[model samples]
Target: MKNGPLFFFGLFAALTLSWAGTVLLSHHQLGGLAPFYDENESAAFPLRQPGVAARGQLVYADLGCASCHTQQVRRPEFGADQAHGWGERQSVARDYIFQARPQLGALRVGPDLANLGGRKPAYDSDDLISLLYTGVIPGAKAVTHPYYKFLFDERPVVGEKSAVALKLTGALAASAGSQIVPTERAQSLVAFLLSLNNSYDYPEARPFVEKTEKKEGEKK
Candidate 1:
């Protein structure tokens, strides 16, 4: 009986040491990952947030989006990073260090979102938001995904909402037809999605030293 207890204790100790070692190694490696470029010139790099992204991240988790869409991107060989137009290089740990509880999702039920910021026009946040809430583009003939229109506000206003299209964002309400309205929740989620830009792929954004030479006409 004493031998049994000792053997179990040794096993437990080994497991604990293994887990602790894994944690230490991961922290050392990931915590030290380098930034892709200097913050000033690289628009693709993560920019300063006004404490909104974290709240949006909470919305993302509540919506159960991680179950379908993955935020982490492996190299091209592992998946359709090239074919699906995610990015040229694999996602590194540095991309997500700012997030308190980083979401490195496991499954690929939907396209990866590691690099989605510039994929559409700068104003396409509404489009994505609408799609997320209603599962279809407005005026589109058909849609395959389930409708999340229930998250939006369907009531029409008296004259107009915001001229800047802040009207585009509000609580979603289910509509009879396939009307795609972006909800407040969906808008926040899109805000979080649009925040995931990584600069290393684009050459212009990469840090480099430029050289200049005096012209022949103006030589000293």
Candidate 2:
């Protein structure tokens, strides 16, 4: 207690050690992870994203979607991610090996999208495009999602109305002679969302079942 300099040195050492253990150690463990190769599928896990999906990933980052949604699913014992139909298995580093900038978001305001593309009753490209334009789930009463109307443009129909033009009603309907069509950016963003699939079962992603020994008790 009398040695003030020694006390300060000890405190600094403790802080430095903790940072190294938590931050540096974790990076070292997962930084060089590689994609898992599935023999039956004859392709490596975490398939590379196409050019449009890659660009869409950039858009996703710019729009700060990660602020509200997470891309990772927790282990079954840790949470009900699998039971709730979020994912079949816990997410592992191998799932993001091909991503330029993995969006392992910090929050979970929205559902985990790691397996969105592989969900039952899969959401097709058109479905995602419509959702982005309208912010309304097909049957839901309330429109809780933020509408990305700016992603689309209202242009007067030329020779033919756009095939991709959204069919709207009520206040959201386009003005007469105009149709709402998603821009290239919007299309790419949808592609990115639809590309979010991590359904492959990697060895590392499987749950760890701890073995226990039976104590020599009266009951057999």
Candidate 3:
């Protein structure tokens, strides 16, 4: 019985090493295949001011948020993901070529963020930010999302809603509450999210590409 167990373990180890060697050897070939067969496109609008989004990526990683959320969308065969509109297609390698370390998260506690940039209502970044800070969607039942009030400053409102602010300011002001309000940080994060639109299917991105190509041709 002891010999049987040892033999199986050894066999497993050998097979694992052989598989690793084969994959490593094939890695270059796989990369070369991307630009040829991979027609995946880049995001549409500018979200983060390049530096900020790069920093926000650090935020995503530092928070360990990736543990609970997967950035990639699985195709139809792997699951019923299509019905949810999480993404239109399975994530391909080209989608992440620019990431210094891509965030193909390991689990799915939260919905996939693959196409979240333009997916939300009216494509509103503020609403998403507010949701992140409150986690209580006003009249809706309490949600399981985390509150991120620790990351923002409490500033006075600028527009016509100051009256409601005075009422809530007594209780919900940054000083009185433990929440971060998430306005700017959420905006930054949403900027990052809104940037996730790969134009492979989105009509919104097409015009921008044409305009840019025209400009470049004129320059040439």
Maximum-lDDT candidate: 2
Model 1 vs truth, CA RMSD: 7.5
Q: For residues 71-161, could you state the per-residue lDDT of candidate 1 as single tens digits?
A: 7766667767756777655676666767776777888777777777745334367666656555665557467556666565554443544
Cα displacement (Å) at residue 181, model 2:
0.8
- Candidate 2 residues lying further than 4 Å off, grouped into runs, are 1-16, 210-220
Each model's lDDT comes to 0.62, 0.84, 0.58
Q: Could you give candidate 2's per-residue lDDT for residues 109-218 as a string of tens digits?
A: 87888888888778887877777877877567577788898899999999899988888889889999999999998989888988888777776776664645635431
Candidate 2 whole-model C-alpha lDDT, 0 to 1:
0.84
- TM-score of predicted structure 1: 0.71
Identify the runs in model 1 with alpha carbons over 4 angstroms from their true place: 32-45, 120-123, 137-140, 162-183, 201-220
- Per model, state how many residue pairs clash: 7, 0, 3
- The C-alpha RMSD of each candidate to the native structure, in angstroms, is 7.5, 6.2, 9.0
What's the TM for model 2? 0.83
Ranking by lDDT: 2, 1, 3
C-alpha TM-scores of all predictions? 0.71, 0.83, 0.62
lDDT of 3: 0.58
- Residue 43 Cα positional deviation in candidate 2, in Å, after optimal superposition: 0.9
Q: What shift in Å separates residue 210 of candidate 3 from its native position after superposition?
A: 32
Scored against the true structure, residue 137 in model 2 reaches a CA lDDT of: 71
Q: Give the per-residue lDDT of model 3 (tens digit) for 1-220.
A: 3799899999998998888789866775565533323234343322223665666677777777789888887765678765677766666665665565667888998778776764534355555565566665544657678877665556544444322122233344455333333444455665666667543532321223333434422321
